[model samples]
Target chain A: MSELLIATHGLTKVYRGGVTAVDHVDLEVRAGDVYGFLGANGSGKTTTVRMLLGLVLATEGGIELFGEAMPKAGASVLPRVGALVEGPGAYPHLSGRANLTLLDSTDGRRRRGDRRRRVGEVLEQVGLDPADRRPVRTYSLGMRQRLGLASALLRRPPLLVLDEPTNGLDPQGIREMRELLLSLNRAGTTIFLSSHLLAEIEQMSSRVGVLDRGRLVLQEDLATLQAPTGLVRVRTPDLSTALRLLDGQVVDRGEGHLVVRSPDAAALNAHLVARDVRVTELGPERRSLEEIVLAASESA
Target chain B: MIRVELVKLLTRPRTWITILALNALPTLVAVLLAVTDLGPRPGTGPPFLSAVLTDGTLFPLAALGIVLPLFLPVAVAVVGGDAIAGEVQSDTLRYLLVRPVSRLRLLVAKLVSVVVFVVLAVLAVAVVAYVEGRLLLGDAPATGVVSVSGSTLTQAEMTQRTGLAFVYVVLAMLGVAAIALFFSTLTDSAVGAALGTIGVLVASTVLLGLDAADAIKPYLMTRHWLAFVDLFRDPIRWGDVVDGVLTQLGYLVVFAGAAWANFATKDVNR
Candidate 1:
């Protein structure tokens, strides 16, 4: 029901050597959605991101950002969109502040006087020291990654397209980045995050799109993909008694547990308890994001 | 966008280092001439090398001649070649493009930056040579500079002609910049682009010496590089000067057009 901030109509890209990096992907990201684009390495995720940003021209089909035809209207539309593709890039010889200042200057729409304030704000927002005088070359990988994010956030655009945003980050840094992104999303910034990391997409994305071998193998809401199956997993101390009691309904047997073809976990547990079976752990069966993605990849 | 590029160029250490290297040869020559008090006999060396012994003001022209053949063009090639390819190498080109800087604007800014570098190098060489000539070489003869045609040149005429020669040398280097920039767009390696430009210049020089290549000699990129020397002749000959301008402009148009055609539609996968 919300507005679609990004929509691609059968977009595709084929390199000169006949390599189809992306094939007929109709990506749709609505407003206020944390769209997680999942793919394995070399599965055309980067190519799709590049096409969306107008860095790589699509060989066929079309792209629209904020409802305007993309690439053709990139000059006007891109100013409202921020992105970090592949990795962060900056002038190594320049200080972080200087690099951001120059990059910010590229957007002619921003007033010159407000640049320093904006740069400082983004640096602090990314947990970086705005006063750090060291050149970017001296910064650690994490610092450079943060700087890249800062550049993307400089304009406070309504949309952020970040590819592998948590890359090169230690656990603490990743946590901070996730928190920052979530806060931004809460403040009404739509996020299109692309990564091969399932755990990341699983945690933050409201909607998910999976790319496999240059094809959009699956696109659905994270909740839909992760919804409970019509089954219940039960761990019992008396495994034999539970198995005998639910012989025909038992679908899968694992280490110390049984998956029963029952929709209500409480009812299944009650039935087992009524038979004098000791139920240790019982819950509704739901596929993990990893399992879902793997299933999609296999089918594709 | 042009302003941003110029800021990048001016802030870069490589730019200053190249400029300093360019001035080194001319400065060293000035010191040697001052110490030994020996000048190659008139008409035997780079355009005004011998003339500088008695008239220091002419050293600027001599300095231009010293670097014009190789050093100046090499510097231009390096800077121009690095224009687009260097960004690609560092992974910044995509960021800039996605910053929504139009491909045309970026290309124009790069071309302008290269032109600024050419102008800066030529001007630096002339200024450094002027000081060295004043302090370490001779003052202008009281009768003023002796024109190449064995005629007297007033102070005003000498200064005016030197300025003209300066502009001409800058124009010549612009042709080199255009070539290097075109190559820059074709590859992501800055060194490759620079070397390719130098390779073309070297080939032009090699062919210029072979009578068998005479038919195309007049159109070679380096063909009229020395035409500025004629600016010193009394009642200056405009024939070669005009041809040199036209030839350089032709190269600029053809090569810059080729670079734009390739780059504007490039996939920018890097």
Candidate 2:
């Protein structure tokens, strides 16, 4: 088992007006895992991220990052973790390069001489032009998003916590961002990504956790959640003949397809073909991430 | 962190614009005094105003007097009030905190930046006023400046006292900065914090004029603000000057501590 990079035990948060933003959620993310955090609007994903980063104080329970208690060991632990919460924020009058340099200067451990170089490197890493001198106020939303990612990657941190990282990006920019994140993950950076876009999470996440109305409704590996359902889906012109041959094994029927309660799709296809039934398509039925999340939320 | 904060303060265009606005009033006063030669009746207007018509060297003091009561304090309140709250408003406070900058260090850096701004504004006013006084107003007599006590003060003595007054003015403005900073940490709106600090100063000024508030008058934040005038007296009246310094320091310690205590534990949801 890989070491747990982030662990929260019975974590909860209650606002001053008695609104529970995050209920008892025990989240665990191991090293090298691309953990996708999923939730609807106002489902406490951002609040939980803030707590993990020590921006918001937790009302109950505890959080441990890299094996040390958080918001207490934050001074030491945070330097190793990079984050972009909500969206990009920069001084409106400063160029993106200048903003990154200023933010880098806040960390005393970074050498002064290396700041400019590091800032340039991160800007290029995020597909931004380091020579662009326009103030951030004039930047397009996609440019600002890239700048935000550049800032988070400035120090080459071991972990990245990004909320809606791909927001405000065009299709091309989103694909670029996805590729960049995948490359970074392959290079050994743990990522905790929070978004409402299931497709984004489905494409990249190794493990997934879904939050619904202040509760962790689901937490499982993506592969496990998307595993085959021990049923076969067949599409054919001879639907009646296939159904008669399969008889009681047919669980569901559509216009030109049938869902058969069989574990082996190929064997079912062979049985139908030997009986003079032409099979157009045959495959095992499996759930998508969306279906799993919807079921989990409904059950919760 | 202090260096970074100072860099931020110095690089901002608003800082320079505010200092320019601060020097405007004093410069206008100098130009008007030079053109019309109508100085306020002795002791009736800003301290040393009537005297500056005769000795240009004394215009720095006159300029300080002109802006000390309202303009300088307002500028200080705006800058200090924006210290923390502006970060919150701009959404940069969380990024800074997660940079692993400790809360106490960030607060200290913010206070230092505000102090630097106060010093810069005060210095700019004094320097600009000196040039304006020399070029546009009467030249000082070869003998020396006449003290507030109607005694002659040597040039060296006058320079020393002017420097002392500059330091005192900076210290006085620090009291305002501390209060504004304390209020800044309490709200996410920079404008609201600035207005709240101004409100406190206005209340203090109102109570200072009321006889019914006499018992607490000595401790009022603005009560000792103009006591720097005593720095130019013949024998140098130290009573009010000392009290003023101590009072401003008292305000600084109390309000800065309050700001730190409140901000260190803030939820920072913004």
Candidate 3:
């Protein structure tokens, strides 16, 4: 098995006033995978991330990062993980470069040339000019988001945990953030990010785990889950021919219609047409991430 | 860690502005004393004011004395109060804590920053007053100190005692600093922290003023704040000054310890 960079065993967290924020979540993110944590606004996504970082205490479960138990090993484990929780919080009075430099000074690592050069490099990496002398308070919201990402990337660790990383970015900035994350993933960094934007996750993540009301509803690879979960219902005068062409993939049978499950519904339609079967209806039947989460939360 | 915090303190405009505002009272005292020579004689005014007019180097002690009652303590309260709460309010404490820095060390660094701020503010007022005193009051060497028993001490000894007085004043400010820092961990609002710390001091001072509360006065942080004045006595009355230093050191230990304890377990959602 690929090394699991992040693994939690029945991790749970219950806040004050008897509120269960996260309940028995057994989550896993392997090495070299962009694992997207999908959830609703208050579905315990941020709380889970905070627990993984040892920022918040877990009520009843265990969390291990890189095979070491955290928060006991938080000193050793946290250094190897880079995170951007909420948009980066900067000293509004200091220039962007100054803010990053101050944060970099706290890193316990070997010196790799002058610190100023590294600050400049990360600033340029995030598309922010290091020479910009304006204080962070003067930067636009998108600029702050970019600066937040730059701060996260400063350490260049093996795992990057981000919470709503593309929060305030415009479309162009979001695409750039997506590209940056993808490039980072390609370079062998395991990226675990949480977001409610399904399209963003679908486009970026290799595997996904959906959290609904403090519980994991689904966890699967994008490709594996891409297969249609149900069947496309079709009605036609030559339904018997369509049924014969679909083989044994039928999910439902009726008098003059048949329901079949297939990822390639277009290919099935072509096959039916080649056999001279008239088709009245055809479409893929799969639940969207949004609908799945909504259903799971409502049920909870 | 201290270096990072110092950089943060120096970079903020609010820091400089606070220092300037704190220094204002001393500058006014220096200017008012220079003009008209309408200074209060010994035993007629606050600590060290009469002696300050003759010797320029003595003005720093006088400045600290003038501000210590409420002005300097309030400045210390404001700086210490803002240290952690300001970061929490701005949400930058999360980034700082996420680094390899532990909560204890972070708190230590914050406390150190407040100490550094106190030193800087005191020195700013002292330096400006020293210059203003030298320019306005002329370079008269400090006169001899007359003891209550009619003994005299040299000017060099007087300067040395004044040095100790400045150092003691800084130590006194640490009591307020420690309390403010402790409150800083309790709330996310800087203003709330400042007010809370100052409120405790105000209540203590009020109790100190009440004879019915005389039994608890020795233990109160406010009681020993003005004890730095004892350093100027010809015999150098060490009794109250010693109690004052010990009282502040005790506050530092208790309050700073509590701040660390509270912050280490904080969820830090902000």
What's chain A's TM-score in each predicted model? 0.96, 0.97, 0.84
For all predicted structures, in order, the TM-scores are 0.97, 0.98, 0.92
Residues A1-300 of candidate 1 have per-residue lDDT tens digits of 889999999999999999998999999999999999999999999999999999889999999999999899998899889899998998988899999999999877779998989999999999887545679989888899999999999889999999999999999999999999999999999999999999999999999999999999999998898889998989988998898999899999988999899978888888889989998899998899999989998988
**In model 1, which runs have C-alpha deviations exceeding 4 angstroms?**
A244-247, A270-277
Q: By TM-score, how accurate is candidate 2? A: 0.98
**Per-residue alpha-carbon lDDT of candidate 2 for residues B151-253, written as tens digits (9 for 90 to 100):** 9899899999999999999999878999999999999999999999999999999999999999999999999999999998989999999999899999999
Q: Which lDDT tens digits does candidate 1 get at residues B1-270?
A: 998899999999999999999999999999999999999998798889998888887898999999999999999999999999999987889889988899989989999999999899989999999999989998857678778999989989988998999899988877898999999999999999999999999999999999999999999999999999899898999999989999999999999999999998888888
Question: For chain B alone, what TM-score does every candidate structure achieve against the true structure?
Answer: 0.99, 0.99, 0.93
Between the candidate structures 1 and 3, which one is better when assessed by lDDT?
1
- Writing each residue's lDDT as its tens digit, candidate 3 over A1-300 gives 889999999999988999999999999999999999999899899999988988888999999999999888988988889888877799888899889888999764647368788888788888999444689999988899889888888888899999999998999999999998899899999999999899888889899998988998788787677757756777789977777777888889888888887767788788788889998887877766566656656776
Off by over 4 Å in 3: A230-270, A273-287, A295-300, B138-150
Pick by TM-score: which candidate is best? 2
Q: Better model by TM-score, 1 or 3?
A: 1
State the DockQ of every prediction. 0.79, 0.84, 0.69
**Error of model 3, residue B126, in angstroms:** 1.6
Q: Which docking category, incorrect, acceptable, medium or high, applies to candidate 3?
A: medium
Query: Which regions in candidate 2 have their CA more than 4 angstroms from the true location?
Result: none
